[model samples]
Target: MAEDDDIAERRLAFGRAFIGALPHARALGMTLVDLTEGRAVMEMPYDARLIGDPETGVIHGGAVSALMDTCGGAAVMAHAQTPAGTATLDLRIDYMRSATPGRAIRAEAVCYHMTRSVAFVRATATDGEEGRPVASATGAFTVERGR
Candidate 1:
């Protein structure tokens, strides 16, 4: 039981440190909502400064990409037996629709697979809706062995 508690504490510490280390995450108002084995959830609040189309009040695609990427990295880190650190090797995002105006975007990422060298993650961004995603993404990340 003590060992399990230690592991849980370490995981929480890692999540906090990872989120704090990213400047873009801070600037974009990214918040770490949950972190557990193989999954992570994050949220980014809409801000006027992040608008891509002033006329439409849509947040920029770049912001969404950043959120997905960060969420993916967090998922990789959360996976049990994950490497010491990971870097995104490839990320592909599909924009299904623009985010709802005045709504915060939430991203959930799952590290579905991990091998010796890479981790595979799938993620989606939504504005507090069911079955409707503003964007979806798949990514591969390099797993650094041997801390």
Candidate 2:
């Protein structure tokens, strides 16, 4: 239906704007690959400037963390119950392994639960590899609605 398509477009635009508005996300070249209610996927391309170690050529952990965090916030913002704004309250990330050199990293986040004032999100980052994730994260975010 036209209404459904309109809503989807609006949400996608919101997700793009949200990522574009963040300086860190811009600097890291994160792309909004997909977005829907309660879910978002983002990608960060591999760049030598973002390498953590010259010897390993692995992407920095901080860049991965930022990608996950931004993806989580986008998921929360896209949730049906979330209206105006969201902010990261807490995020815990576990690095499973270094990202494969020269490979772009993709992160997907789901807003699994939401309360009146908070949202819970889980996310995973992979470096173009199937089954093996570079990192996984869980986060809580403040939610503001009806604004």
**In TM-score terms, which candidate is top?**
2
Q: Estimate each model's TM-score.
A: 0.92, 0.94
**Which ten-residue region of model 1 has the weakest summed lDDT?**
8-17
Candidate 1 residue spans exceeding 4 A from truth? 1-10
Task: Name the regions of candidate 2 deviating beyond 4 angstroms.
Answer: none
Residue 32, model 2: lDDT of 98
Candidate 2 displacement at residue 29 in angstroms:
0.5
- What shift in Å separates residue 121 of candidate 1 from its native position after superposition? 0.6
What is each predicted model's overall lDDT from 0 to 1? Answer: 0.93, 0.93
Give candidates' CA RMSD values in order: 1.8, 1.3
**Which residue pairs clash in candidate 1?**
none
Q: Candidate 1 on 61-103: residue-level lDDT in tens? A: 9999999999999999888876888999999999999998899
